[model samples]
Target chain A: MLEINHLRKTFGRLVAVDDVSFTLQRGQLLGLLGPNGAGKTTTVSMIAGIATPDSGHVLIAGRALSGDTDPAKRRIGLVPQDLALYEELTARDNLRFFGALYNLAGGALDRAIGAALELVELADRRNDRVKDFSGGMKRRLNLAAGLLHDPDILLLDEPTVGVDPQSRNAIFDNLEVLKGRGKALLYTTHYMEEAERLADRIVVIDHGRVIADDTLAGLQSRVAAAGSPPANLEAVFLTLTGRSLRD
Target chain B: MPLRPLTAMVRKDLQLFFTDRRAVIMSFAVPIAIASFFGSIFSGPRGNAKPATIAVIVVDQDESTISQAVVAGLEQDRNLKVSRTAVDDARERVRRGRTSAAILIPKGFGDAAGLAFFSGQEKPALDVLFDPSHSMEVAMVRGILTAHVMQAVSAEMFGGRRGGELVDQTLAGLDSTSMPEDRRKLLRDLLGSVQTFYRQPDRSAGGTGLRGGLTMPYTVREEAMTAGTNVAYNGYAHSFAGMGIQFLLFAMANLGIEMLLERQRGLWKRLRSAPVSRLSLLAGKTVSGTIISLMTLSVSFGFAMIVFGVRIQGSLIGFLAVSTACALMAATFGLLVAAVGRTPASARGVTTLAVLMMVMLGGAWVPTFIFPAWLQQATLVVPARWAVDGLDAMTWRGIGVRGAIAPTLVLLGFAALFAGIASMRFRWEEA
Candidate 1:
C-alpha cells in the first residue's frame, strides 16, 4: 500500500506539486496521468524519498518516508523516467548491485535477479552489458533492476517512454504479474491507453493539482456530465484538462 | 552503514572503470606512457646513462705536501674529474670548457694560506680560472674546494690531538705585558670556548645543531650513499617523479568529472533512491578514487623503475606513506571538484585548468630550483609541490623519514581540507 498525503512542493514562486494527494491499495495499480510540467515526476520524487516535500509526506504501508534511505524506503522501488541502469555494467551486475542495496545478497539476490530477468524476458541476455543492448532491452533491464529488491510499492515513471512495442507489452505483462501477486504500483505515463489498460484507478492531475480521480467508467461519466460525452480515456483526459498544450 | 552496498557500489564503479577503455587508458596507461617518455629523455645518452662530470685541472705550483694533498682531494672526489697540468695549460683547459675550472696553487701559497686565512692578512690567492657557460658547475666546484681548503687549513692551524694544546700554547705567549687586561681576557675566553665546542661535537650535536651556533664552517663533505654513482644528479629519477605526480593529479581530478557524468545521466538518482546510506555511497566513491589513484601512481613509478632504474633511495615506509597521502589528496580533490561543479562539461573545464595550474606551479614539469625564489616559496601552497618533493626526497635526494614527515602531513591536511569543503558543498540530489 502507498499513501501520498497532500504533498506540496515549490521551487521559488512556481508550485511544482500543490496539495496533491492519492492512495493505492494492495494488488491495485494507480495510473498517474498529467501533461508536461503537471508535477508527476515531482510527486514521485517525494514518494521515492529522493526529494523533500515542502509540506505533507509520503508513506509506504503505514510508515512515512522521513528522510533519505529510511526503513520505509526499502519497501518502495522507483523506476525513474530515464533508464537508470549502468551502461558500463552487464544487466546481471546492474541487478545484483541494486539488489544488494536492500541487504539482498548471495543466493537470495541471485534468485531475485533471475526472477526479475525472467519476468522482463531478459534472462538470456542478462550477462550482456547494458550498453550493448538495444534501447528496448535497456528499458526492460531498467524495469528488472527496480524489481530486484522485491519492494511492496513500485513506482514506474514513464517506464515505457522510448521502448519498443514488444518491450512495452512485456512491461505491461510484468505489472499484471505484480498485481496478481498483491503488490501495489503507481505507473505514470503520457499514453492514455497504457493508463486505461493497466491502471485499476486513474488519477488525472493538472497544473500541480488533482483534477479527477476515478475508474475508467467513473472518469468517462464525470467528463460526460460536464457536457461532453467522452468516448474513451483520451477524450476524458482532454475534456477534464482542456485541449491546451502544456510546455 | 551496511558494507554490502558499499562494496557493491565500489565494485560497480571499478567495473565501470575497467570496462571503459578510455578511462582505463587515461588512468594508468597515460601516466606510465608520459613517465616513460620523460624517463627515457633523461635516462642517459648512448647506453652509458651517466651524468656529465665537471672537469678541473689542478696546477700544484707550490709542490708542498699541502698543495699535493689539495690536488689529490680534487682527484679523489667523483663529482669533478681532475687533471694535473701547467698553470697556462690549466687556464686554457678551463677557457675551452674541457674543465669547469682550474685550481692553480701559486708559489708559496701553502705556507702563507693558514695564518692569512684566519688572522686576516694578505696571502697568495689560489687562482681559479673558470668557464662562463658552466657557471653553476664552476660555482659548485669552487664551493667544494673552498670548503676543503677551510677544513685543511683548520687542520693545519688548530686540528689534531694537540690542536687544543696548540691554541693554549699560542695563548700562553699572548703579550699581557702590553695589551689591556680586559682585551687579553676577552680573547682568551673566546678562543677557549671555540676550542671546547669544536672538540666536543657530540655535545654540540644535542644543542643548536642546525641553528648555526658557533660551529666550524666548511665542514660540509660529500657522502656517497650509493657506491659507484657516476652521475651527480639522477635526471631519470626527477623526471619520473615529476611526470608521475602531475598525471596522477590529473587522473584523480578527472575521476570527479565521472561523478558529474553519473549525475547528468540520472544513475546517481537511482543510487540515491536505493536503501543505501549516503555515507556509504560517498565513502565508496572516495575509496574507489583513492585506490585507483594509488594504482596509477604505482604503475607509473614501477615503469620508471623497471625501464630507467629509478628506485626509492630513502625509507621505503616513508615513501609509501607519502604516496598514500598524495592519493588521498587527489581523491579528495576530485570530491571537491564534484562538489563545486554542477555539470560534467563545466567541471571538466574548471578542473582541468585548476589541476594543470597546480602541476605547473608544483614544478612537475620544470625543476622548482630553477624557479624564481618567490615563485618557489609560493608553490609551497600547492599540494602537488609536497607530492613531488615527497617522491624526490624518497628517491634521488635519499632523504630519510624526517624529510617525508612535512610532505605526508601537508598532503593529509590537504586531503582533509578538500574533503571537508566537498562534504559541505555537496548534495546527493539537488532540487
Candidate 2:
C-alpha cells in the first residue's frame, strides 16, 4: 500500500533519482533493483521521507506524505543502508528506544520490543551490548529496530549488505514471515540473486532511470522475445540495464 | 513534539554518556583538580587571610650596634621575611630568585652615616641588590628599609656615644671649611643644639628613638565591602566557578561532537525517518546536555566546598537561577556547534580552540580584575564571563537576587540566541 509517483531528486548539478516510480502492495515484496549508484537508495529515501524529492510525491495508504513530522511517516519503517544501532546500548534498549519513537510505551512497548527481538531470533541476546555482538548480529538487531513499531509498510535498503550467509538467510526468512502477515515491503538491492529469490515483482533501474518493471518470468519472456533467451535474472538485468560496470 | 520520543532520546544519550566510565570520571576529575590547584594558590597554604611576605636577605658588614638595630627592625616588620647571609651569598640569592632583594650594610657604614648626619654632607647609602623580575617586591622592600634605616641611624645619632664623637668632629670640621663667618656660626649653632639635644636622658620617649621616629600619620582600618553583609571572599568559590564553567563547556561541546558522530554513523537519518520532528530531537539533546553539565558543575563545587571551604554566601535561589541559566547556555552552545560543524574531527578541533579562547578571555584561569581595561571590557560579551561573575556574586560578593538577576538574564539570552541559531542552521543529515 505504498506508491512513489514520478519521483525525482537532485543534489546540486547531479540527478540522483529522475522520473522514478514504483508501487508496493500488501503481502508483496517489491525489489527496486539497480547497480551501485543507480538511485535505488535515493528512491527509497524519498519514499521513506528521509529526503525530499525535487518533484513528485509519495503516498502512504492513499494519503500524500508531506512535512518532516507527518503522521504518514509512522506507517513506514525504514531499515537504513547502514547499521544505525547505538553500540553502547543493549539490544533490548535499542529496540525500546526505537519503539518509543513511534509513541509505544509501558507494556505495549515491552511487548513490541520482545516480539521484534523474537522475530529477529535475538531474544536470548537482548541484554548484550551491540558493540559486543558480531557483524551479523548487529545487522539483525538493526532490522529488528525498524520493525519494533510494527508499521504496515517496511522499507529495507541493503539490509544484508555485509551480513554473513546465515544472518542473510535469517533476514530472508523474517521478511517472508512479514510478507505472510500482510506487510508491504520495499526491498532495494543490487544483488540479482536476492531479488530473484525474494521479490514477487522486480524493477530494474540504471543511471536514475527505470529500465524494466515486471515479474521474473515476464522479464525472461521480454529477454527471449529480444532474440536471446535469458539464463537467469542476472542475464535479464544485464540485457535490460546493460553490461557496463557501474561504479 | 511528543514527549515520549524526546524523553527516550534524552535517556539514550545519558545512558551512552554514563556508560563510558572514563569520560564520566574525567568530566568531574579535571575540573576539581584544576579548581583545587588554583584555590590553594590563591588562598595560601592554610587559607589564612595574610598577604604574601617578601623574602629578603640582609648582609650586615658593619659590626656596630646601629647596624644590628637596623637588622632587628626589619625582622620585626610583619611584611618582610629577613635572613642574614654574606654579601656574596646575598647577591647569589637575589640573582637566583631565592630572595626578592638584598639589603647590604657596608663596612664603616655606621660611622660614615653618623658623620654625614651632623655635618649635613652626602650620606652613606646602604646598597640594595634585587631580582629584576620582582620589581614590585623590590620597591616595597625599599620603602620598608628606608623607614628601618632612618630609625636606627637617627636613634644612634640622638643619644649614643657615637653621636657625641660625630658632633665634635663636625664642629672641628666647620672651622676648616671656606664659608662666610655668619654662615659658619649658623652651622655651629645647629651642631651645638644637636649636642644639647643628644645629652638629654629622656630622649628615648619623644626624640628620634625607634618607636617615635618615622611614624605614620594615619592608621588604616580595613573592612570587607559586602553591602553590609558579613561574607568574606573565598578563593575556592572563584576558582571553582572559573574551572567549573571551563570544563562544563568542554563537556557540552562533546555533546555536539556526539551529534556529529550520530550523523556520520547514520543514526540521524534513521531517527529522522521516524515521526520525530527536528525540534524534538534538538530539544532532547539540549535537555540531556544541560542535565550533564549541571551534574558536572555540582560535583566540582561540592568538592570545593568539602575540601576548600567554599560557601554560597548569597541567595540560594539566585545561585540556582544563574547555574541553571549557565547550564542551559552551554547546552544550546553544544547544539550550535553541531549545527555549524561539517564533520566530527574538524568540529572537535575548532570547538576546542573556541572553548579555550572563550574560557581564557572570560577569566577562568585568572580574575578579570587583573586583565587590561580593554580586554576586561571586551570579555563582557563572552558567556563564560557572565557565568563566572554570577557565581562570584552568589558566593563571595554576597550579592542577593538583585545582583544575580542581570547575569541570569544575560545567560538565558545567550541560551535563546544559540538555540535560535542552531534551529535555523541545523541539518537532518550531513551536507
| Top of the candidates by TM-score | 2
Residue B228 CA displacement from its true place in model 1, Å: 11
Weakest ten-residue segment in model 1 chain A by summed lDDT:
A222-231
Interface C-alpha root-mean-square deviation, candidates in order: 1.5, 1.8
DockQ of 1: 0.45
Candidate 1 lDDT tens digits, B9-43? 77887888788898778777777777677666664
lDDT of 2 by residue, B331-386 (tens): 99999999999899999999999999999998888999989899999999999999
lDDT of 1 at B99: 77
TM-score of each: 0.74, 0.90
What's the CA RMSD of model 2 in angstroms?
Answer: 3.4
